[model samples]
Target: MSMDTRNLLVELFVEELPPKALKKIGDAFAQTLYATLQSQGLLEKDSMLTPFASPRRLGVHITNVADQADDKQVSQKLMPVSVGLDANGKATPALLKKLNALGADESAVANLKRESDGKAEALFFHSVVQGATLAEGLQKALEDTLVKLPIPKVMTYQLADGWDTVNFVRPAHGLIALYGNDIIPVSVLGLKAGTTTHGHRFEAGLDPVFIRHADTYAEQLVKEGAVIAGFAERRAEIVRQLQEAAANAGDNLKPIDDEALLDEVTGLVERPNVVIGQFEETFLDVPQECLILTMKANQKYFPLLDADGKLTNKFLIVSNIRPADASAVIGGNERVVRPRLADAKFFFDQDRKKKLESRVEGLAKVVYHNKLGTQGERIERVRAIAKAIAAKLGVDAKQVDSAAQLAKADLLTDMVGEFPELQGIMGRYYALHDGLPADVADAIEDHYKPRFAGDELPRNAVGTVVALADKLETLVGLFSIGQVPTGDKDPFALRRHALGVIRMLVEGKLAIGIDELIAAAEQPFGKITAEHRDALLNFIFDRLANTLREQGYSAQEIDAVLALRPQRLADVAERLAAVRAFAALPEAESLAAANKRVANILKKVEGEVAAKVDTSLLKEDAEAALNNTLSTVKPQADAAFDRGDYTASLQALAALKTPVDAFFDGVMVNADDTALRNNRLGLLATLHAAMNRVADISRLAS
Candidate 1:
C-alpha cells in the first residue's frame, strides 16, 4: 500500500571502468531502475535508490521500494462479440471451440459475464485479470533490459569465444543482484549473476567470497578496509584525513575546488587513503594556476596551504592503498609526484627564457581551421576586430591591439603543447614574461569568459573587446561555411559564442546592436554576401531571441522586440524590460483592450477598402481627442527613443489610453462613408508607428 520497504542491490563487477564512463553508466542504471519501479506502480518519493561506480564495479542500492505492486484490474475484449456468431443463436462449429476454451480456462479469466444477442445465437464476455507480484515483474524486466543498457564503448576479455563479441564497455567479471535477502538469478552476457559481491579487487581475487544479502554489502566492504560506494562518503573521508595530516604538518589544507579531481580520486580508490606529500619550495615560484594544473592533471594530487593563506610547498595525495606504515605510503606518493613538479618547473623556466613575442613567428606554421586560414591569419583578423570593438567601447586602443596580437602566441608554447587545457592560461603567463602590460595579459586570459553558462565575465574592458571579437569571428566563420549549430550539435560552440556576445553587451552595458556588430565583424569575411543576407541575419537574430527568452522572457515579449528590429542591444533589453513592466500598467491594460477593438474593426473592412484617418473629416469628439493624444505622445516618445529610455516612451504612449478607448466604444471605425473609414485607418497607422517606437503593441495580447 505504501512502500516495498525492501532494499535492492545490484553490483556488476568488472576488471575496471574508466572514470568518464562511471558517471554515464551510474546515471543510466539509476534511471533504468527508477523507471522500472515507477512503471511497476510504485511511488518514487516513498522509495530511495542510488547507484555508484568505481574502477572495478558498478553498484546500485534501492531502499523501501513498494514491496508489492498495487493491485491491478484489467478488462479484456473478446473478439468483437458479434463477428463470428450468427443471428440464429446456436454456436457455429467455428465459434463453439473458442467459447468452450474460454469457459474452462479459470486462470486466464477469473470470471466471464456473457451478454446474449436478441437472436440468442452469440455471447460476449468481459474477463477479470489476476494481479501479479512486483518482484516477479522486476526480475522479468531486468532480463529484457540488460542488452538495452548503454555501454557505448566496449572492451571484452577472458570469456567464451563469442564473449569477445559481447557488447559492453568492459568485460563483466561478476554480478550481485539482490532483493532484501533473496538473490535474483539473472544471467547477462554469459555471467552467472548472484546477490553476493566481494569487496576490493584483492579480496575478490584472493578469497572468492560472496555477499548473501543487501544489508551486509556496505559493511562487508568496510571489514575489508574498503570505502567502496558513495562519492560523498569517500570525499568526506579524504577531507577528514587531509585535515588531520595538515594539523600534524603545522599547515591547513586549503581546498582548490577541483571537482573533477575529487571524482577521479574517488573512483581510483576503493578505500580512503590520505597521504601528505611535499616537493621543494622553489617549485612554488611557478604560477599557482600552472602548478595546480600540473599536480591535478598529471599527478592527481591536491595541494595544501600554510595558515597564512598561501600555497605551501606541500600537497595532499589520496591513495587507493593504505600501506601498513603510513609514513612509507606518504613517502612513496611524495617520491612519485616530485618528479612531475620537476618537469613542470623545468618547462616554466625554459619557456620564460624566450620572450613570448619571439614565439609569435611560430604560430604562422600552425593551422587554426583548414578552410579559414593559418592561426597566424586568425590572429590578424582578431586584432582588427578587437581594435574596432575597442574603439567603439572607448577602451585604450593600444592595449586592445597589443593583447589581440599576443593572444594566440601561446599556441606555439611548449607548456601549452604539453597541457592543451592551458591555452588561455599559458598566454597570460607568456604575456607577463614578455614584459607586456597587465591589460594585455588580462585580455589574453579573460577573452575566454562565459565559457559555459554562469561562468564569470571579463572584469576589464580590454578583455571584453577581445571576447567579443573572438565570439564574432567564430560565429561568422561557422555561418559562412553553412555549418551553424543544428539541433544541439554545436561543434564550434556557436550558441556559446552568441551567448557570450549577449553577456558582453548586457554585463559590460555596451550599447551596440548584436546584428550590427556581427555584420561589421563579417565584413572582412569574403564569403558572406547579399544573396544569403536574410539567412545570416535570421540565424543571428533568432539565436538572440532564443537566448534572451531562455534568460526568461515570454514568447510574445521575445517576438515583440525582434519585430522592432532593434539596432542597439541596450535598446532591445530596455524595450523588453519596459514591455514586461508595462504589461502590468493600468494604461497598458486599457491600451491592449483598445487595440484589440481596433484589430476587430479592421477585420470587417478587409476586402472592402483600406481605411485612412482624414484630418478634415474628423467628426467624432473621441477621434479628435485620440488624434491630439497621439500628437502629444509622439514627440515625447521620440525623445525617449533617442535617449534609449524605452520605459518613458512606453509610458508616454499610454497617454492615448482614454481617447483610444472612447473612440472604439463610441464610433464605428468602418462606416458607409469610405473617406471617414479611410481616415480612421490612417489613425491606426499612426498608432502602429507610435507603438513601433517602443514595441509592436499589436503583438501584445488583450
Candidate 2:
C-alpha cells in the first residue's frame, strides 16, 4: 500500500427519474459503488464520499481513491498429497494434469509446497496476483451497481446501432468516470465514459459542461451548467426560498410543513426558483384540507397558511427556470391549480346537497370485501359493537349508534370518492351540514383517528366508542374469514387497527373488557367467529405486548402482566407499573424465586389444590411462620389490589420474603403424611394466588 491517492468522480446522465425514489437511488448508488471499491482495495480508510441526485442524473464524488490496489500473495490448492505424489514422492499423472489446468506443467512440481489441510496433507501452488487497475475495478463496480439497483420499474431502450438494448430505471444517455484529471474509461448502460454531460436541460449556461478534474465536478456543473448538482444543497435552497416567500406574505404566516412534498419537489428540478401564486378567494369556501391536498398532490404546490393556520388563496411553487419577467410563471401555475381547486369546490358543494344520512343507503351497494359482505352490513356490526361498548361506558347508546351508522357514509360522497384520504373528514362536514349534533359529527371523523403510529386519539367519549367498534369489527370479521395477517402481509392493515384499539382502551382509561368486546363484535359473524374467536383475541393481545415492548417496557414485565390475561384493558398499564416497582424492591429476587418454586411444586400435583390450609397440619416452625405471615400480609395486599393501587399491592407482598425463604429452606412440601402434604399444597396455592394479583412476579425470577 502507498500514500498516493486521487479524487474520483462518476456520473450517469439519464431521463427524468421518479421523484419519490430519487433520494434512495442516489444513496444506494454512492454507497454500493464505494463499498465495491473499498472491497477491491482502491479506496483509503479516510476517504470521503458525496452523492448527487437530480431529475436527470445520479453521480458521486470520492476523495483519496487509489489508482490500483496492492498486490497480494495467492494460494491454489492442487490435490491431496497421497493423490499428487507416488510412493517415492515423485509427481503423479493426476498432479501433472491439475498443473496443466492451472497454466503450469510438471516442471513446476519442484516448487509446489506440501501443507496439512485439516488431517490430510495437500499440494499447494503459491503465486503473486497483481492488483486490479482503476479501469478494471470501476467497470466491474459500475456494472454491479446498475444490476443490483432497487429500480421500481426499468425501461428498455436500444443503443445507437439499434441492435442491442439495456434496461435501466430510465435510459441513460451519458457516463462519466474521472480519476484526477484523466478518464477511467469505464462503461455502463451501453454508454461509454466521458468528461462531458448536459445539465438543466432548459437553463444550463453551457450546452455540454466539461469536467477538467475529478474534484471540480460539482463546481463545474453549478458554474458552467447553471445547475445545483447536490440534493441536500438544492433542498436547503428550496426551504430558504419557501421561508422567505412565506415571511414576505405576512407576519406569523408560514408554508405548510410537508417533508415528502419538499423532497419530491427537490428531486423534480435541477435548479429551483420559488414563486408565489394565488387563486381566486371564492374557492377558499371549500374545506381547506380538500384545497391543500389537491394543491400538494396534484400540482406539487406548497399551500400558504395565515397566522391562525388557515389556508389562504396564496401558494408557493418551485420552478426549474427563473425568468426576469416572473408574471408568466406565477400566472401559469395559478391557472393550472384553479381547475384543481374548482374540482375540490364542486365535490364539496355537490356532496353537501345530499346529507350524510341520505348517503347511508349508497353504502349497501359498495362491497367491503368479497368475504365480508358490503359496507352497509359492516356498519350494522360496528353499530352493534358501539352500542355494547357505550352501554359499558354508561354513555348515550343512541348517539353512539347514530355516529357508527353514518361514519362510512362519506365513502359514497363525491369529495371522498375523488380523494379516498378524505373519507372520514368529509363525513364529519356532511354530518354537520345535516344538522347532526357536534359530538356525533365529530365522532364520525374521529373514528379514523390514530390512523398512524404516534397520531392523536379520538377527541371525545363518543368518538372513542365508535373507533373501538370500527376497529373491532375489522379485526373479528377478518379473522373469522381466515384473512389474518401473515408475516409482513397485512393487506387490510390489521396490525394498525389492532394498535388503534389498544391505544384507545389503554389511553382513554376505559374499563371495557377486551373479551366482552371481542365476544360482542363476533356475535354478528355467527359461527365464523365461534371457531376463530380465541385466535382473534390472541392477535389483539400480541399487538398490546408489542406496543409495550416498543414503549421500552422489558419483556419479563410484559409477560408477567399479560400472562394473567386481565379482562379490563385499562388495568394493563397499572399492572405493568406495579411489576416494575416490585422488581426494584430489595426482597423481590428472593420472593420471585420462592414463588417459582411454589408454582413448580403445585403444578406437579395430580389435581387442583384447594386453598384450605389447616393450622394443626403445619408442624414445622418455618411452615408456621409462613402461615402466620400470609395471614398478616394477605389482607394488606388484597386491600391494595381491591382499591386499584397495584404498586401498593405488589409492595405489600415484599414483607413475606423472609418467611417464604424460611419455608422453602426448612419445610418439605411433599410430606410422608397425606394430610400434611395437602395442607402444605394448600398453603403454597394461597401464596401463589396472593402474590399474583398484580402480575406473575415469578417471571422476574433469575
Candidate 3:
C-alpha cells in the first residue's frame, strides 16, 4: 500500500574514502539500493530517497517502503498434450513423472487444463506464488548491493574472526539496517547488522551514537555525534562561511568558485570550520594565475580576490576540527602556504632573466612524440605552415612566423617545467619582457585557443594564423603514422584539433580552403601519401557535420549543403541557410524531384555528354522552352552566386520551375535518334550545373 509504507535506512561504516571519488561512490551506493528494493516489488512507485556521505560512511534513507510484496498467479507449462495423454484421453507415464517434479501427483492432472500453444496443445498448471517477507527480501538485497557498488579501488583485509577475508572499497567496520525503529537482520562484508554506528573520530561527543529511529539519523548524528551527516547540507554550510569571510575582508573581494575543490574539501571534513590566512604581499609580484594555481592545487585553499578580481594575500581554509581558540589553526595554515608561494615567485623570477627567444634552441632536446620527432622540429613545421597560410590570406608573413617560432619556447622555462599548464601563458609574459611587438606577444599566448569545446578563438589575425598552423601540424603528423582516433580513444586529441580548426575557419569567416591548408601542412612532412591526406580531410568534415548537427541543424539541410563538397568553409553556414530557405518554398519538392531524375539519367550515360546543344535538333516545344528559360535564368543565378548572395542565387532558380516541369512531362530523354539524345543530355547537364552552384538542391528531395 502506497499510503501505509514505512521509512527504511541503511548505512555502511568504513575507513576514510578517497576524497575525489567519495561523492560518486555515495551516490552510486544509494541509487543501487533503491533500485534493488524497487525491483523486488517492496517499494511504491513514488518513494523518495535521501543520500548521506561523509569521510567515513555512506548511508541512505528511503520513504514509503513495504513490509512484504503482493502475491501473484503464475502459469507453468507442464508438457505437450501428446506426451501427457494417451489416445483415449487418459493419463500416460510421462504425465505422472512431470507432475512429481512440481510437487503434484496423478490427482492434480485431472484439474490441469489443455491449451493450444502455437502449433501444438500444451497442458498448463496454474498456481499462486507466495509474497516475500521483509526479512527474506532484505537479506538478498543487502548482499547484492555491496557487490554492485562502483568501488574505485578495493582492499582485502582479514575479518575479526581471523579465518575469513573480504574485499571492499575500504575496510568495513559496521553496517546498519532499520525498518522503522526495529533492526532488520542483515549481514554483509563479514559484518553483522546493528542499530548503532560510530561518528567523527575526534569531534563526536559520544563514542557510539545510538540510532533510536531510522528517521532521526541526521539529527542524532549532529546532536550526539557532532557530525553533519548529510553531504549536501555540509557543502552548503561551507559555502555560506566562505561567502561571509570574503565579505568581511573589504570591498570588491570574493572567493573563487571551484565546484571540484568544494566537493573534495567537503569529503575531507565532517565538522567544517572556515579560517582566514594571509601571505606576504610581495608574492603578488608573480602572475596571479601562478599564485592561484599553487594555492588551490598544492594547499587546497580558496584564494580571495579584490574589486578588480585580482588575487589578494588573504585566503580561506576549511579545517575539520573547530577549536575554541582559532589562532593556532590560522597560524599553521599561513606557515604552510608561504613556501608554496615562495617557490612560485622563485620560478617566475628565474624564468624572466632569460629572453623567450633565447630558449628556442633548448627545445631540440625535448621529445614531442616518438614518431613526430622533437619539439624543435615540430616548431619548424608549424612556422613553415603558418607562413604558407599567411601568403594565401594576404597577412604579414613576418608576424605569423615570429609567433610560431616562439609558441613552443616556453616549454623550456622553469615556471612551465614545474607546471606544464603554464606553457603558453608564460611565453606571453616573457615575450612582453623582451620588448617584442604586442601582436606577436599576444599571439604567443593565444596559439592554444579553443582548447576545448565552446572555448573562445584567437583575438587577432596573427594569433589565428598560428593557432590554425599548430592544430593542423598535430593532426597531419599524427594521421600520417596511422594513429587516427577510433571509438573513444583519441589519446593525442586529434578530434579536438580538428574541431578547433573548423571553429576558426567558420567563426572567423576565414577565406582559407581546408584542402589548401592540408596541402600546406603536408608539405612540411615531405613524402606523405595521398591516402593519408584524404583520410584527414574526411575526418575534418565528419567533425564539422557532427558539430553542425549539435547546433540544431537538420540532417537533410546538412546533407544538401555538404553534398556539394564546398572548399571554402566560411560559406558553409550561408549555404546551409540557403538550403533551408529553398526547402520551405512551395515549388521546392517538384524541382527537387526533377533534379533527382536528371541526376539518375546522367549517371546511366556511358560517355561524357557533349557541351554544345544543336538548336535545330530540338523538335518538341518543351525542349525548346526549357532551353530558352535556361538562357535567361542561368546568368542571373550565376551573378547572384558570384556576389556571395546565396539566398538570392537559390531564389533565382524558382522562375525556371514551370519550364522544367513542362519539359519532363512532354519529352522522353532516351530517344532512338543518336543526335537528338546527345543534345537532350547536354541540356540536362546545363540545368544540373546551374542548380548545384550554391548547394546540391536534389538532396532536399524526399
Candidate 4:
C-alpha cells in the first residue's frame, strides 16, 4: 500500500431494516458510494470494495482510497474570435470581461491558447483545478448515496433535540466513518460520525462494540457484539445450520427450498440459531400446501419434507439468539404455531360440510367488474366458451360444462377467503369429496394452470379445454372494454393470459384455430364489433411473436411465419422449423431476393393480376424456361404442403433459383405492350403464391 493512501470504512447503524429490501438497499448504498468517489478521482485505480449488510447495519470497506485527489488540467472554450477580439489582435473589452469572470485577468491574455472551435478560431482558457480533500468528498458521497437508495418506504422520526426530524428507512442511531485509524468525519440521518455501535440487543458482551480500525470492523463486531455483521456470511451460516438440523431430524429429509423465505429469515436475525419443532401428526389431515403455507407465510418457518416429497409434522425455526438449553425456545415456537394450524384445519373441515355447488350461488353477490357484471355472469361465459371448445375437439361437453361452472365456486369458501392463492386448489378437493368425476375435479383446479411464465399447463385434455376457455374469455372481455396492456403496466396480466392461450394451442397441439377460438369466446359476449375482434387477434399474434423470440427463434423467422397470421397456432412451430431449414440452403438467398422483387412487381399493377399464365406471351426463353420449371415443381411442392411436410414443401422450391434469376434478369415485367405486361404479372403472381405457402421468404432478405 502507498504511504499516502489507506483503506476507508463507513458504517450506518440503524434499527432493523425491511428484510425483503435489505439486500437491494445495501448493494445500492455501497456501489453508489464507490462510483461517486471514483468519479471525483478520490480512489486509486486498483481500489476494491467489500459491502456489508445485516439486520441492524450497512457498511463498506474500500481499499486504496486517497486522502486527496490529484490536480486536473481543463480547457474552456470561449466566444468566437470575431466577437471577443478586435482587428488589432489586442485584448478587447469583451475578452477582458470573459477572462476576469474565469478568475483570470488581462495580464494573462498572452498565455491564452487559440484553437479552432468547429467553424471559427476561438480563444480557450486553461487552468489547473485543485483536487478535493477526503472530508468534503466523503461528505458529498454519503449524502448522494443515501438519496439514491431504493427504500421501500421512509419513516420520519425526531432527532435527539426533539425539534428536528429526518426521513430514513429506519431511525439511525450512530454513524462510523474511518480512514485508517483516523475519523474522516461524515454524517447522515441526523447522526454524527463515531467509533461505537451496538450489536445484539441482549447478547452483546460489550454494551457498545468499539471499532478500533477500518480493517477490524467485522472481526470486532463478531467478537464483542455477538453478531455475524455480514448479510452473506450470516445467510450461509443459516443455510448450513438448516441443512444440519434437517439431516439430524431424519434420513432423506430437507427443508423446503425457498430462497425468498430464506432471505427474509436471514434479514430478521443478526445471529441465527436453527431449532426443530413439531406439531401433532393428526393436523396433517389438512392439505400439506395449506399447512406448509401457514408455517412459512404466517410464522416464517421452514417446513420439512420427506424423501417422497410429503410434508412431515416437523418444522424448523430460525431464532435470533442461541442458548445452552433450547428446549424452551422450541416449546415456545411450537405452542405459538398450534393455533394457526388449528385455524387451517377448522376452515378445511367447515368448507367441506357444504358441497362446492352450494357456494356457486354466493358468487352472484361478488362483482367481477363494473361493466362485466358479477362472478356468476363470468362463470356462464366461461361455460359457454368451454362447451364450444369441447364441441370442436370432439370431447364430452357435459364434463367441460360442469368443470367450468364450479371452477370459481371456491372463492366463497372459508379456506379460500383466508388465502386467495388456494382458490382453484380447494375447488378440486371439494369436488372430489362431493364424488364428482375425476376428470371434472381435476379440470376445476387446472383451469388456472400456467399461472406464470414456465409454469406447467393443464394436466389432461379436460383441463386443457377449460384453461383455454377461461383465458380466452378474460382476454376478449377485457379487450372489449379497452383495458389493454400499455408498456410495462399490465394490471390485468393480459399479456400472461395471451401467452397461456398460445401455449395450450401450440404446446398441446390442439386442432382448434386461434381465430375460431376467439370467435367462440366472443360469442358469449354478444355482438362484439369487428374492430375489437381484429384488435384482439392482432394482440394474440403479437404475443405469439414475442414468445417465439424468447424460445430462440430469430426475428426474421418469427416475422415470416406470423405475417401470414396462421389461424392454426399448432402449425406455427412446423412452419418456423421449415423456414429455418430453408434459410440454410445455398439457393435460399437468391430465391428470397427474387421473391421480394416479384412481390414488388405485382403490387404495382392497377388491377388484379390473375395467377393464370398465358404461355403464348412468353417470348423470352428465360420466361418460357421459368414457366416449364414451375409446372414440374408446383405439384411436388403442393403435395408436400397438403400432407403437412413443410420442410419438404419449402425445399422443393430450391430448384426454381436458377430459372427465377434468369427470368428477373432477362424478362421485362412492365412492358409497353399491355398484353405482355399483364401476362408477366400473372406469371409472377403464380410464383409468389407457390413460394409463400409456408412463409414469406422475402422477409429473410437482408
lDDT of each: 0.73, 0.91, 0.90, 0.92
- Over 4 Å off, model 2: 74-128, 527-531
Error of 4 at 287 (Å): 0.7
Model 1's number of clashes is 19
Q: What tens digits encode model 3's per-residue C-alpha lDDT throughout 495-562?
A: 99999999999999999888899999999999588889888988999999999999899998999888
lDDT per residue for candidate 2 within 57-165, as digits (tens), equals 9999999998889998999998999999999989999999998988888889999998999989999999888888878999999988988778899888898888998
User: Which is the better candidate, 1 or 3, if ranked by lDDT?
Assistant: 3
How far in Å is the alpha carbon of 143 misplaced in model 3? 3.9
Poorly placed runs, candidate 3 (over 4 Å): 1-4, 75-129, 610-612
TM for every model, in the order presented, reads 0.86, 0.96, 0.94, 0.96
Q: How close is candidate 2 to the true structure, as a TM-score?
A: 0.96
The sequence of per-residue lDDT tens digits that candidate 4 reaches over residues 1-702 is 124899999999999999999889989989999999999899988999999899999999999999998888999987788877788888889989998999889888888788997899889889998888888889999999999999999999999999998999999998999999999878788888989888898789897888999999999888899998788899999999999999999999999999999999988999999999999999999999899989999999999999999999999999998899999999999999999999999999999999999989989999999999999999999999999999999878999899999999999999989989898999999999999999999999999988999999999888999999999999999999988888899998999999999999888899988878988999999968888888889999999998889889999999989888887899999999999999999999999999998888888878788898999899999999999999988899999999999999999999999999999889888899999988888889999999999999999998
Q: Sort all candidates by TM-score, best to worst.
A: 4, 2, 3, 1
The better candidate by lDDT, 1 or 2, is 2
Best by TM-score: 4
lDDT of 1 by residue, 1-702 (tens): 444457777777776677655666766766686677677764345567677666777777777765566666654345434554457644455555665676643233234445555544334455444434655656655554555467767665546754346657777778877777887666666676675555665533324556768877766666652546755566677777767877766645575667778777776777877877788888888877778888888878888765666787888888777667778877887788788778778888888888777877888898878889887888788888887787777889999988888887877777787887888888898788788888889889888887898899987989899989988888777677777677878788878887788777877678677666876687667648654555656776787888887889998888877876776665677789988887878887778666666666655655643434567888899888888888888889989878878888887887788888788788786678977878877787677667776777767774
Number of clashes in model 4?
A: 0
